[model samples]
Every structure is written in structure tokens, then in C-alpha cells.
Target chain A: MSELDIGILALQGDVAENFMSTMAAMNELGIDGSVSQVKTPDQISAVDGLIIPGGESTMIGQLSMVNGAMNALKEKIGSGMPVLGICAGMILLAKNSKDRVVGSTKQPLLDVLDVEIERNSFGRQKDSFEAEVSLDAMDIPSFQGVFIRAPAVLRTGSGVETLGKFNEKIIAVKQGNILATSFHPELTRDVSLHKQFVKMVADSKS
Target chain B: MIPLSGDLPKSKGIKSESVDSINVTKGTSTLKRGFAHMLKNGVVMDVTTVEQAQIAEEAGAVSVMVLDKLPSDVRKAGGVARTASIRIIQDIMDSVTIPVMAKCRIGHVYEAKVLAEANVDMVDESEVLTPADENHHIWKWDFTTPFVNGARSLAEALRRIEEGAAMIRTKGEPGTGNVAEAVLHIKKVNDELRTIKSIYDSGDKQGLVSIAREFKVSLDLVEETAKIGRMPVVNFAAGGIATPADAAYLMSLGCDGIFVGSGIFKAEDAMERARAVVLATTFWEDADAVKEAQKMINEKQSILGLDVNNLELRMQDRGGSA
Candidate 1:
């Protein structure tokens, strides 16, 4: 694949770190891609792919709405533009997110992915854990998964394929050109996930 | 030079010295009054960006934690420690006059030192979402800067305090979005200490030893630790703090303050949430404030799936050869 133009959502969350990891991933794959921060709707149009970093789901949703990027993101996802959502990003892409714990605050989801997410299903911070799972579709075996206040894929539409699972919970999933993971693959040194995402973008472009 | 006397002649220079001394005395008194004033009324706000920092100040938060990320880094490799950059820290500091704090890895003294130079008032040694530091505890005495270390149990909390920590925080675990763990931890510590004091009056060494063994620690050690500072030293409650009620819950547990990372900025109404948290901590006894705080928590965004076991520190070379 030729050099790909990748953009990371910079409205909130781990914007800079995601950009660095994405660039590192591209370098590992020998793919010369230019990664930049995309906050405006216009910037979305210039990128071949986008990575929504992990953060507080509600804030990202509210900020995106306030900044006028919510609608643009929905439109982009609708157009089958390749996008990767990690952790909070995964919650935002889900059709609906159910907070397992009792609380009153609600998040405005993008509803791009046809899935239901159970927020903080793995318990609190002390209960946070990790596992290795195989993404058979991507031919990646046993990648280390990080789950911080991560959401779980409770249910998925027929179009979505479960890519990886840990402790019988779905952690990675993909639908058409859109991909979402409950764990943060970018947080790790492993770049295979990013490579897979970049390939998806390349395939979509073709 | 003329010899100095107890009572010098009323020369212009001498008179000027007397005036300067009086002014210094007045200045010290004024500073003490100001600190007391802040303790009575100062508020703390949770913020992320520089814009949010400015808004926090306007909303009456006494201090702000310069967090670009929330408590969910447990599942990832490059945790929140590596996530929050220097530029972001500088930006938030530039935007506000109130004390700005940032999260750092537990043993990453280098990061803490850098933050100290940046002039952050305090560093929250929190393990909320970031990867845990290697086993060696932070040597607080090594740094001239002050820090607030997170402790889950009384023993751990007291140890951090013993290490000369400027402040203490109950580690309820980050990203849980629940305050029950924090509540339980604080209650257990306070209750245990009470029990120890009553037993000490009876001169029951065997009873004390048994109790300490049951707790899997030493009572004398804990007492020694407490002696490093005054009892109930600057303790704050953190982790899973999502609403004003949560902040109030911590205060009720005898915490001096609360640290709300994602609760405010992540809420639908950031400004209102910030104000509510401040109110909750201040008027903790007011049922109305508690109700208001409970209503401010975000139910939908509370789900966090951070995996702590997989977050073991992997030594990766950033630029140099391993």
C-alpha cells in the first residue's frame, strides 16, 4: 500500500499519544503515512482513515457535538470510511451503551456500529485485567489486550464479526470497513493491530 | 561600621528598619489568614484542556488536575503517564493561576521532577488508569517537591504519609465509576485505628499482635508511620469519583478533599458539574447539596473495562538500543 493519510480525533481523550502510536505502527509496517490531529469536520475529509483514542465517552460525545464533528463522523462512518475506535471510542461507535453501575449521566453515542456495549463490565479499576486473544481474521495471534474502564460488546449485528475474545467477553470486533476494540491496542508496543487497521483503510481506498 | 545596639538612635535608616520589621510581621499574619481563608472556602475543579482550566477558575475551583485523559489506561500499553505530554501540562499551567496537578507513573521520579520544575503545586501519585510503576515505592524524601500518594488500605496510606508525602489519597481504583471501594477503605482504616487505641489502654500486647496479624500488618509500624505526620494528615479520596455526591461521600469519610478526574469535564454539563462538586464538598451536611450532587453523576459513561493484570511495565526503548 502507498503512503496513507491518517488522522486521529483530537477533540478530547488521548489524542497526541494515539497519533504517536499510529505513526510508530505505520513505521513498523514500513508504511509511510502522515498522521495529524483532526478536530474539525473539514479535516475529516482529507484523511484516508481515522483513529478515535480512548477517553471519557460522554465528554468526547459532548465535545464532538459542540465542535460540530459528531454529524461529520456519523456521515463518514455511513460512507464506509475506514475508522478505528478504541475503548471509549468503541462505546461511542456502539448503537447503545448500558452503564452496568447505577448513575444518571448519559452519553450521546455516534451509533455507527450495530452493537450494544456494557460499560465497566469488568468491575472497577482494581478489577481491571488483561489477556491475549487471536484476531483470526487479521491473522494476528495472541496480542496483549489492555482494558481500563473498558466496555464489553454485549451484542453485535449480523454484519459484525467478533475478532477476539477474553474470558468469554468480546474485546475486538469489526463491521464492513469500521472496526472497534474494547481494549487499547495502541497503548502496547504491538503495531499489528494498527497495521491491520491501515490495511483496512488501504482496501477501502482501493 | 558602628556597633549595633539593642536600642539604636532614632535615625532615618534605623526607623526605616523598624517599619520594615513591622511590615514583615503584618505580611506573615496576612499570609496565615489567607491560607485559612482558602481552607474554609476554596474549591477544587476537575478539568482537562486549557479552556476547561480557565472555566474551572471561573466556576470557583481552588485547584485543577491537568488531565487530558481519564481513569481507563489500565488496559493499554502506553498508559496515561506517557499519554499526558509536557506541552499539555504547560498549556494548562499557562491558562490558570490556581494549582495545576498532573498524573505520573508511580516510580517515574523523572516525570515527577519535570512536573515540579513546571511549577505544579502537587503531583497526584494515582494509579487510576495509568500503568503501575515498578514495585519500588516512591522515595518522597528524595524530591524537594510535594506529592499526594494514593493508598488503598490504612497500612499503605500511612506508609506513604510516613514517606514524607505532603498529602494522602485513598486509592479506590480508577475507572470503576463507583465510590464504594473508597468509602469502605477509609472506614476500615479509621475503625481499625480506633480499635488499636482502645486495646492499647488495656495493655494487651498479645491482643494487639493478633489484630495486627489478622490485618496482615504490624500495628506498631502503622503507629510509627502515623507519627511521621499528624493523624488524619492531608487525605483525599480519588478513583471512580463521577459526581458531586461522590465528592461529598469522600468528605464524609473524613477526607480533606476529593479528586474528580473525568467526572466534571466528561459530564454533559461541565461547568454545572464543576460547581456542584465544589458545593458538595463545602456543604456536605446539606441534604439538598447531596441530592444535587447525586443527580449530577453520569450513568451512561460509567462503564470502564481497564485490565490491571496486563498492564505490567514492559521496558521498551524509546530512542536508544535496549
Candidate 2:
């Protein structure tokens, strides 16, 4: 396969870390793909795969909408471009955000995934935790999940497949080329999830 | 007589394919620490408007602090410098993807509570504003949102930490755009830490206890800080940092990060200067990188910095002096 280009939505939240982790994953996979930050539509359109990193969901959604990146992202995801959404990114990609305390938050959402998410499902900012997520389906032994004001999958559509969970709560979900995880995989030393996502990107490119 | 490693506290239920229950803490302090770690070597810019926040984000700021008035302007206005308007804070929060931090008057728990309710990434019990309480600071431990406070000495930093400040920044003379006071403050804290370290190294437990009594913080926290030889929480340099060189100097002095206020937006070329400051901060050790960042800005375009001595009010003097 030709070199795959991976782009991290640079609108906000751990963009540099995601880029670094993706590069590490590409190197581990022995793929010659380059990882760069993408904030413009032109940059988004050029990537073989994309990542929306964990950050403030409200800010990311509002910024993307104002700059037209959200529309561009929706089109790319619709065209089957592989993407990974972590934490706030996960909340943004979901069809609706159901805050455990506020019910449905009115923040801007991409509505790309047919899943209901509970924002800050674990608790407040002080309630965040690090846990080992079971990703048996991905053939990984165990991925250390970093949850920080992270969201959880309250419900998944029939087409969506659950890939991982933490404390009996859904933390990762997938629908075709789109993948969303509540925990921040990039924050950790482990790049296996990034490798898995890169593999998906490589497969799609072929 | 000792138990096996598997018998360690909460390690018995090691479950696969699930969040390790053992890693959960009573509070999300670990997660907050992780967040602060990610911000190392980054710049947190103070911005007033949504447009300013956008520019900060585009310029690669790790976070943008929302304030109604610049420190200089607050000093000049001479009124109660409270937190930014909630609507403005919300707008800025919505405008940028980076973390948005807002300041509350020292010891104003209600103001901090309102900010937390607004869902800011962090709250700063800042001395730059008029103190709501003369003798005490807000009990940060009561809040779920992590807090950052300013300090001039190790005692101040540890007190804030004991009260649960997730981060610390030197309380330089705000609005001056002069880095001298910040330098002095950070140096004082550093010198105190070095002194404590020597006491610990010499196995002078009595001396350590005396130091703890002087600081008025717990012995355990003091010992932990002494062992680590630094603030337990992330420490960023703030107050009067105007230029990229100023930022680089502070970072080189061992600050984890920097906070630029009135320095960027107050300049003639906000965008270029903001970007340059971020660059210099991220690459403080590299002289070439700092020089490149310096070249990005024209000195004439920089904010006219005020002399620290001439400032009528010293923010560092606010709150508990000890």
C-alpha cells in the first residue's frame, strides 16, 4: 500500500499528542505514513485517516462548526475515511450527548455516530480515573484507559459494535470506518489502539 | 511474613478488558495531574474576547485564560477586579478548543463555584484581583474543578497545594510586563526548596520539622516536596512575561510552563507575538529556537512594559502574606 497520511483534527485537545502517537503507531506498523495536524478543510480532505483528539467537547464542536471543519469532517466520514474520536471527540461524533446530570446537553454535535453518549458519566472532573479497558475483540491484551471528564456510551445503534468497556460501562464503539472511545488512548504510553486504527486506515487505502 | 505482590492493596481483582478498578482514586487528582503533565512546555495565554481566544488557540496556546480586563487595565481602573462576565467566559469557552481558565478573587468561594458551574477547565484563585477575604484563601479542596494559585515562596505554594491547588504560578507584579519580580519570586521559592533539600540530605529531621512549622503546611507534604525538590503540582511562570525571550528565560529557569497576559494582545502585532511566545516557551533550552521566535517579533511592536517598583499595587502582596 502507498504511504497513508493521518490527520488529527487540530481544532483543540491533545492534537500534538495524538499526532505523536499516530506517528509512533505508523512506525510500529512499518508504514511510511506521515502524521500532521489538520484544521482546514483542505488538510482534512488530504488525509487517509483522521483523529479527533480528547478535549473540551463544547469548544471543539463550536470551533469546528464556526470554521466549517465539522461539515468537511462529516463528508469525509461519510465517504468511509477512517477516524478515531477520543473523550470529547467521542462525544462530538455521537448523534446525541445525554449528560447524566443534565440529561441531553445542547452542545453542537457531528451526529456521525448512531450512539447515545453520557457526558462525564463517571462523575465530575475530580472523578476521572485510569482503568484497564478490555479490548479482547481487537486482539489486544489490555489497554490502559485514561478517562478525564470523559463520556461513555449510554446506548449504541444496532449497526455499532462494542469494542471495549470499563466498569461495565461502554467506553469504545465502532461503526464501519468510524471508531469512538471514551478513554484517552493517546495520553498513555500504549500505542496499540493507534496501531489498530492505522491498520484500519491502511486497509481502507487498499 | 510478608504477603505476595498479588496481595497488594486492591490489586487482587485485576480484571482484563476493563478499567482497572485499583487505579481509581478517591478523587480525580491523578487525572488532573495527567492533564497538567500534557501542558508541560506549553504557553497559557490570557485573552478577553472570543476573537482573542481564537487567536491564542491558532497560535498554539495550551490553554487560554479568560479575564474581563487585562492586568494593567485592572490596575489602572482600581475597582474590584472580579472574574470575567459569565457570558463572555462562555463565549470564549465556546470559541476555543483549548482549555479555558478563569480567575476568581482570592478567597471568593462563591465566584469559584460559579466558574465551576460554568464548566471552565480550571479555576485560578488569583491575587491579581481584589481579595474577597483579607486573611484567607478559598479552600480549594472543596471544589471538584482543579485550581491554580500564585505564590512568591515555597510556603505559599505548599499552603495552596494543601488546600488543593492543582497548579502553581509565581505571583509576579501583574500588568508590568516586567519579568524582574517574577524572577525574584521564583528564585526565592527555588532557594527555599534547595535549603530544605540540604536539610533532608543531612538527615536533619528536626530542621525539616522547623521548616514545616515555618511554612505552616503538613510535614508529610513538606517532606514529599523536599524529596521531589519542587512543587508537587505543576508550576508555571506568570506575571509580566511579555516577549518570547522573557518566556524562554522563565522556562529555562525550570518553570513547567508560562502564562502570558497583556503581553500578546497588548502588543502591536498580537498574532505574530503570540505565536512567537508559544514557540520560545516550548523550546526554551534551544537558543536557536528562541532566536527564531525573537525574530518573529519587532521590539517596537511589543507592549510598553511598566517598571515593577512604580506599580502602586503589588498583586503578590495580596492574600495571606505567609
Candidate 3:
């Protein structure tokens, strides 16, 4: 596969860690991918894949809209660009969000994944936790999942395939070239999820 | 055969090493210690810019809570609030290794993700600030990064802990600048724990059932006790922490740390106040430090009048209400 350039959405939250983790995952997978930080709308065009790290979805969406990166993201994702949304990033990708306890947040959402998310269904920060999730489709037994104020995929559309679950709630889902997880895979030492996304990126490019 | 010191009453179930050792001395008191030096007695600085973070660090703060504005701003300027920028977060991370934390609106997993991506030592799901999603809680099973959450009750704290939050903090509603609510919540949790322990000690199934029944009614208390059982995980006090004494008082209540947002910067002597807060965290029981801290109080400047409170985005969920 040709060298793939990966960019982490750097507007807010977990950009650096995601960049480092993606790079590490690419290196581990023997994929020659250049990882960089993407802050502007134009930068989205330069990368083969985008990893929207975990962050406050509303802030990210609002900022991305104010900064004009939201449209760019939608356009890129529309063009079949492989993207991975972790935690808040997944909320941003969902078609709609439910249970947004703060207020009516009408930020730009990618709407790439035909799913509805219940933001903070896990109660409060004190209720945040970790567990082993079984993603049977990936042929993996279980993966260590880290959830910090995470969102759940309340309802997924027909195109989306459920990838993983914990406590009976869908935690990970993938639709075509888009992958979204309610947990932070990059936070852990585990790079398999990143590797899987990289593989998807590679497969899509091919 | 065993020495009296070895046989001295230790916290039930907690490993001898895990129980906090409190030693009282005439002039100096033995500083309380916890697992992994989790900053049990730490100072929280509400900082927006990297410069303030530096000042806080240099001033002896154990940790800093990076925000886009001081609490005063949120009260005056009503709008969507932003957290510290990536540049500032990186700058602060670069400046100090003493666990820098940032707040994300409630259920704003993306913010947590961003903080995690930034490699922030920890993130706080701040209830004092507005939430991104008004309805849902930030699901704890999502990210690998450790986070802290604010709780008003023991059940809330325990639920958060079960959700995989690395730490729990008492949610003393922010912007109020009053610590009364937090104090009450802490006391309630403690009092309920004692009651539950007594019932559990009776060693009867009926006693267990009664305790469980009580737990259902006071879910937060049960959760808090369960969280306490999970050693090494921190339960700090946050919101409305105003002075060195306040920080020290929280420590005295058995909080692992204190998250002070507007307390330091809002005061006239920002540096001096921050330094005093840091001192309080380490030497909370020391008379000299207390005396020194008392002198550092700034009566002229109050965080309430500042516009720090108006800066955050307060989105409410459609289904669930806090």
C-alpha cells in the first residue's frame, strides 16, 4: 500500500495522544503512514484518514463549524475518506444526539454514521469506567475498553454494523468506511483498534 | 507475639499500607499519604492561559485545572464556553508533570477525548459547568484515559467509579463560590457509611438485607462506600473551594485532593494565594502553614463579581435532567 497520511483533528481534546497512538499503530502495522495534526479545513484534504480523538462533542462541533472545518469534514467523509471517531468524536459522527443534559447544542455533526447517540448515558464522571468488550466481528475475543464520560450508540441504522458491546449497550459501530467507538483506544497501550482502523484506511484506499 | 503497633486497629478490609496514616505532632504533623501519591492533598488552580499554569506550578500548586476562563467570566458572559486550547494544554503539560487536569461540559465525551489526546494527566466531567449533552452521562466504558467526575451523593460517586473513572470528586456547584453544599454532601456520605458498616458487622442475612434496602434509598452513600473500597482510585473535593483553609478542611474530611478554580486567581494576591493553597495541601494540619495561609487571604478581591462564570456552554439534554 502507498504511504497514507493520517491527521488528527486538533481543534480540541486528545489530539496529541491520538497522533502518537496512530503513528505507533501505523509503525507497528508496518504501514508507512505520516501522522500530523489537522487544525484547519484545508488540512483535511491532505490526509488519507482523520482520527477525531475523544473530546467534548459539542465544543468540537461548534468549533469545527465556527472554524469552517465541519463542512470540510462532511465533504471528506462524504468522499469516502476513512475516519475514526473515538468517544466524543463518535457523538459528532452520529446523525443525532439524545440525552444531551447540558442544553440544546446544535453544533455541526458529520452525520456519516446513521446512528443516534445518548450522550452521557453512563451517569456522571464518577460513573465512568473500563471493561473488556467483545467485538466478535473483528475476530477478537475481548479488548480493554476505557470509557471516560463516554456516549453510547443508542440506535444504529441499517448500514452500520455493531462492532462491540459492554453491559448490553452498543459501544462500537462501523458504517462503510467510517468507524466510531465510545471508548478511547488510544489512551491504552493497546494499538489493535488503531491498527484495525489503519487497515480499513488501507482497504479503502485500495 | 505480635507488637502492639502492628496490632493497632487498622481500617477494615483496607491493606495496612492502603489506610492513610495520620500522625499528630506538636509542631509538625505527619502529612497524609495515599496510593501512587495521587495528590490526595493537592491544590487546584483555575487557570486559563499557560502563563497562569506556570505561575500555579511555580507557586507550589500540586495540580492545575485548565479552563478557558475564570469562574467569574462564566457568571457575567453567558455563552458557550471553551476549555484551554491545545497550545496552552501542551504548554502546561510541558511546564509541569504534576498531573494537569481540564474540565469538559457534562457528557462531552469529545472534550474528554481531546484531553486524553492532549495527554492531560486527567479530565474532570464538570457539573459546575454546563454540559454538552443535556441528557446523557458520559459513558465511562469508552476511553482508556482516566477521568474524574463530580458527585453529589455516594451512589453517584460509586456509579462513576464503576464507570471506570479514575477518580471521584464532590460536586460543590461551581460559580456559587460557596463550599457549604460540598461539605454537606461529604458529611452525608460519611455518616451513611458508618450506619451501613454497623449493620454489616452484625453478620446476619437480615442485617445484610436491611443494609441493601437502605443502600437502595441512599444509593449515593452506598456508591461512595463502594468507591472507597476501591483503593488507589481518588475521591477529591471540587467546586467552590475558596481558600487554603477550605482545601485543608476538605483534606481533613478525607478527600484525596481539592479542585480550586476561581479561588486563587480571583484573589488579589494570585501568586501568594496559590502558594498558600499548595502549602495547605501538603501541610494541611500544620499550624505554621495555617497561620501563614491565613495571612495570605485577599479580602479586597472576590471571585463572585468577576465575569468568569459566563464563559461555558450550558447544553441541556432532552431526556435526562440532572
Give candidate 1's error at residue B176 in angstroms. 2.5
Weakest ten-residue segment in model 2 chain B by summed lDDT: B1-10
Worst 10 residues of 1 chain B by lDDT: B24-33
Misplaced by over 4 Å in model 2 are A1-132, A137-144, A149-163, A166-206, B1-27
**Which candidate number would show the highest lDDT if scored against the true structure?**
2
DockQ for candidate 2: 0.14
Error of 3 at A147 (Å): 21
**How badly does each model clash, as a count of residue pairs?**
25, 6, 91
Q: Each predicted model: what fraction of the native A–B Cα contacts (within 8 Å) does it retain?
A: 0.00, 0.22, 0.00
What would the per-residue lDDT of candidate 3 be over residues A1-206, giving only the tens digit for each residue? Answer: 67898889875555656777788898998888799888678898888999988755654665576557899999999999999998878988999886534433454678888999987666433345556676788766777676665788888889899998776789999898899998878756678888888888888888
Go through the candidates in order and give the C-alpha RMSD of each one to the true structure: 25.4, 8.4, 19.1
The residue-by-residue lDDT of candidate 2 on A1-206, one tens digit each, is: 67899999875456767887898999988889798888778889999999998766765675576558889999999999999998878898999887665465457888989999988688655456667667888888788778776788989998999998777789999999998898888767689999999999999999
Candidate 3 C-alpha error for residue A150, in Å = 27
> For candidate 1, what is the TM-score?
0.47
lDDT of candidates 1 onward, in order: 0.63, 0.81, 0.65
Return whichever of 1 and 2 wins on DockQ.
Answer: 2
TM-score comparison, 1 vs 2, better candidate: 2
Going through the candidates in order, their DockQ values are: 0.01, 0.14, 0.01
Q: What would the per-residue lDDT of candidate 3 be over residues B1-322, giving only the tens digit for each residue?
A: 0000111123121121211232111100000111112243455677988778868766656567888777656655677675668788777766553346787877787877788677665677776466677666676445534467777665565555545455677776565566775687677666755665565455444654555464343444343343334322456777677777887887788776677877777777788777767666555666676667767776566454322234243211111233
